[model samples]
Structures are given as structure tokens and as C-alpha cells.
Target: MAKVSNILFVHGAWANSSAWEKVLPLIGAAGLTGTAVSLSLTSLADDVATVKRAIALIDGPLLLVGHSYGGSVITEAGSDPKVAGLVYVAAFAPDVGESAGSLGAGGPPTRLLEVVRPDEHHFFKLTREGVDEVFAQDLTATERAMIFATQNPLAGAALGGEVTAPAWKEKPSWYLLASEDHTIHPELQKKMAARIGATTVTVEASHVAMLSQPDAVAKLIVQAAA
Candidate 1:
């Protein structure tokens, strides 16, 4: 296996690069340079483009770490030859022709879904109650408030966009399943991880495991990078 020289993180829907703030330093402490891409969340193509741009900036083997919708971005962009591996942290790992919306369609409705408010432009945001109670339940009150305050509204249509190529098929992959994840069901995570043939690890955390369980999340990235 080639040594992973850098790490690029992609955040999920309704989130920005700040989502990886806690995990970045930990990844650095482990002796790897880490960069978190701030996606527009307006469309999957746009997000994947941003990820590819980030990949272009780095040299040598890279580990792509994605959370939520970010996983979809990496799935599409990780095909870059510079990429060495992928680490999915409670993210949607869709296959070719499958969109995040389609993969999540059969899952049971979650509390987070009930609280999603959409703007006229079709961008979706989580209600404060939803953020506090379900999305980041394991986080501190202040952290949860920050999440709600800084969240980027994701275009609802982005979820329906399909992947042309799923990088997982060509790259070594790992998955961190948030056992208590409410936004993306744990069972769904398991199914996707199995389908992708990734080495999977389960942690007792919510959807935002990177925030509440940074150490655990960082550890998995380190393993994937190694």
C-alpha cells in the first residue's frame, strides 16, 4: 500500500468546512496534512468539482474523508489517480446511477426530516429543534448552537443528482458508522459499507460524529491513511 500523504475532507449537506474543525488538528497531530473543502451544496456536480480542485492542490497519495453528502462528493471525485483511499464518516455512499435521495428513499423517516425547512429556492435547512435534538444530539449545547448558526442551506435538488462513477469501486475504502445516527440510518450505513466492500467500524454517536467524537473519527482516518 502506498503511504497517504494528505487528507481532504468533504462535509455533508447543510454543513461547511467548519464541520471538520475538530478533526483537522487531530489528523495533523498524526503527521498528515489535512484540508477540508467548503462545498456550495447547490449541486452534486459543483461539490465534486470543489473536491477535485482540492485534490489537484495536493501531491502524492491522498485520503478522502467525507461526512453525509460529502461521501457522495468523494464517491464521484475520488476517482482521481492522486486519491489513495476513502473514509466515509456516517455518509451516503451511493453507487453509479444512484443518487443520495434514491439511496435514502426506502429508509424510515427520521426526526431530522420532520424539521427540515425549505426556502423558496429549494434549499433545505434544519430547524433549531432538529439540530439540538436529533442531528447533533451528542454535541454540547454551544456546539449544537454553532452548528445551527453556521449551517449552509443545501439545495434539495442536489440529493437527486446521480453519480456517474463511484470511486469506491476503484479505491481502498473505510466506513465509520455512527451507530445512533438519526439523519442517515445506521442500518443504511451498514448496507452501503457492505456493498462497497469497505472496512467498517461502528461508534455510538449521532450523525455529526466528527464533532462529538472527533478522536474516534480521526482514528479511523488515520487507519485509512496508513
Candidate 2:
């Protein structure tokens, strides 16, 4: 029988590697080590290098999963020979010649864009309210507040850069559509999924569905690894 493959998770903007904490153990239970990647989110080069470091650690075949902006990272990182498949969880799966910023051009979900502030380094971080309303909308009041306090600011340059090669165009792709996601509109998710020819599934959860609906997310990852 074939052995199970490793599952590497790349988290999106305003988040650290810990974003996949709840879902990691579930993936492990299925006999796959779920490695969570924290991108610099400052530059495409930095983020891709971070993902390559994760790829190098895996000795067997792998299933690379990306959520939100992390999708942009995996789109390039998944090109490694060890990467066997790709899973995008309401993540950006831009096609060739597409920039991450272009994906959101359909329209901003709400007025949250106004709350973003950039430092001298051009890294963008959301305000506390931005985190509560846009990101952790599915969490409890306490959970949401804590997340806001710990959120990381991503570099604005990450969004403007284009993905050189979209792994989805070369590899088998799977997409999880967060039906209730407020961060990236559900309509855009469908558009991205269809463009990449991904096998698609929908969940009525928020942006962080891996946290809010772990079992459902794990099932899909486990299936891809299997």
C-alpha cells in the first residue's frame, strides 16, 4: 500500500503559523504531518523562500495547502518535485500573469480596507476592529479580541507582485470555498476556483474555516494526501 503524504499549510496575511494549530493535529491523526508555514508576506521572494524551506524538510511526497494570501505563496512553492497536489482553502489561486491584488479587484468586501495602515517599511496591518470584523468574525468575542491583539502585519508589496507560475495549472488542485467568508467575497472564491480547474467543495464557515470547521478541512486534506 502507498504511504500517506505530508501536508504543509501556508497561512495568509495578518496571521502567523499558529493559525493552523487547531487543524494540524487533525491532519496528523490521519498519519500526515501538517506543517504550517509563516510567510514574511513582505515580498514574493521572501514568502517563496519560506515555503521552499518547508518543502526541503519533507522527505516524502507532499500535499501543499494555502489559505487566503498564502495561496499566492503555494502557487509558486508547489512546483517542487515533492509536492504532489495543491489545496486552496478560500485562498488565492491566481492563474499565469495574475497578481494577488488583481484577485481582489472584483471589489473589496467592505470598508475594512480603510482601516489598514502601513509602516515606513510598507507592511500593512489591520486595526483591531479590522481583525474582529474581517478576519475572526466566526470566533467568540474573547477569541476575536485576542486574535486582533496578536495579528501580524503583512508587507504591502506581497499583494502587488505577480505569481510567476501558478502551480494549479500544472498540478491537481482542490479548493475550499468559504461560503460565509467576509474577508474575500464568496463570489471571488468561486471565480478563482473555476479558473484553476480545481475540484471544489463549499462550507458555510468563515474565512478561517480551518479553525471554525476543522473536521471538514481535514477531511479534504486527508483525501488529497491519500
Candidate 3:
């Protein structure tokens, strides 16, 4: 068995390390530490570098976990020798020369992107409607509000950052499919998981499955670590 030392989490657009707040404690309860990387949401390279920096601080083999755009981050950064496995939570998994933007286009049309509003600075933010109706429709009112308030708008360029070498090509992986996800389609999740040859678990969750189903999310990460 691979000796996984720790679990590292990467958050997607409009989210921070706090996005994994609900699941981190669960991981600790199982006697393993989990680190969440707060991406700058600047671009793919910047986000991947952020994950690499987090990986540098951790010791031993790591289970890299990602959600949404964070999936793209781990796919690139997981190529690191220290990484042992990957766990995708309602995440994107792009291949060489592919970007999350391009992959999403090839998937079914979704309402989440329709509600995204771009600013003069080129950062893309989700509208209130996006959060309440599509992005996290299954979450509680408070949870949805918190997500909307704490969103870290992603740079437009972040969507186009292409992967050079997808780590999933070399690492074992697990995928958590959010059946009720509105941000990334469930079919797309399956497609990516199949492409990466990931062990997949499906849950009736919104895009934010870690928050909505922390127990399930934590279990999958722990399984990967094991």
C-alpha cells in the first residue's frame, strides 16, 4: 500500500480554503491531517503553483484533492513526485493542452456560467441568482449566502490555462460525482472520471458536495489515502 502522509485540498473558483471547512474536521477525526490550499484564482499556472507550494510544506506521500477548477490544478500539480493519488469532488479533469474552459464547452450547457458576471478587471463572479438557484441550490439558505459573500472571483484567464502533463496519467484517483450539481454537469463529471480511470462514487449533492455531504467526501479522501 502507498504510505499517504496527508491530504491536500484545492478549492475552485469563487471559493477559498474554507470551502473545505466542513470536511477537514472529519478528516482529522480519522487521525489524518488535511491541508486546504487557497488558490489566488488568478490563472491556471498561478493556481497550480499555489498547490505546489502547499505540497512542498507537507511531508510524505499526499492525496491531492480538488473540486471544480481545483481539479484542473491537481491534474497539473499532481505530477509532483510527492503526490500519491488524486480525489476529484465534482471537479474537472482536463487532458494535455486542454483547459477547464474548453472541457466545459464540450459538456452539456449549464446555468451556472450564465449567471457569472465579469468585471472590468476580467475577474468573473457569480450572481446571487447563480448561488441561490444553480451553483448551490441544494445547500441551506445560510450556506448559500456564505458562499456568495465569500466568493473569490476567478480571473477570466484562469479558465484557459491548459495542462501540460496531467498527473492523473500517473497517479491513482477517485472521483465524487455530484448528481445534482449545477456548476459542472454530472455527465461531465463521469466523463472526466472515466477518462482518468478513477474509482467513482456518486452522491445526490450540489456542486459543493464537501459541505453538503462531508461524511461521504471525507470517506473518499480517506479511502484514497489508504
**Which candidate has the highest lDDT of all?**
3
Model 2 C-alpha lDDT per residue in residues 1-226, reported as the tens digit of each score: 1444688889988888988988899988887887888777888779989999989988888888999899988998889988888999988887776767788875556455766788998888888777677776788888777777878788878887788887887789889999988888889899889988988999988888888888889999888777
* Lowest lDDT 10-residue stretch of candidate 3: 1-10
Rank ordering of all candidates by TM-score, starting from the highest? 3, 1, 2
What shift in Å separates residue 84 of candidate 1 from its native position after superposition? 0.7
Residue runs of model 1 more than 4 Å from their true location after superposition: none
The collision pairs in model 2 are none
Candidate 3, residues 187-224, lDDT tens digits: the string is 99999999999999999999999999999999998888
1-226 per-residue lDDT for model 1 (tens digits) = 5878699999998899999999999999999999988999999999999999989989788999999988999999999999989999999999989988888886666676788999999999999998988799989899989989998999987898899999999999999999998898899999999999999999999999998899999999998887
Show where candidate 2 strays beyond 4 Å.
1-3, 107-109
Higher-ranked by lDDT: 2 or 3: 3
Q: Candidate 1: deviation at residue 184, Å?
A: 0.3
lDDT of 1: 0.91
> Can you give the TM-score per candidate against the true fold?
0.98, 0.94, 0.98
lDDT of each: 0.91, 0.84, 0.92
lDDT of 3 at 62: 86
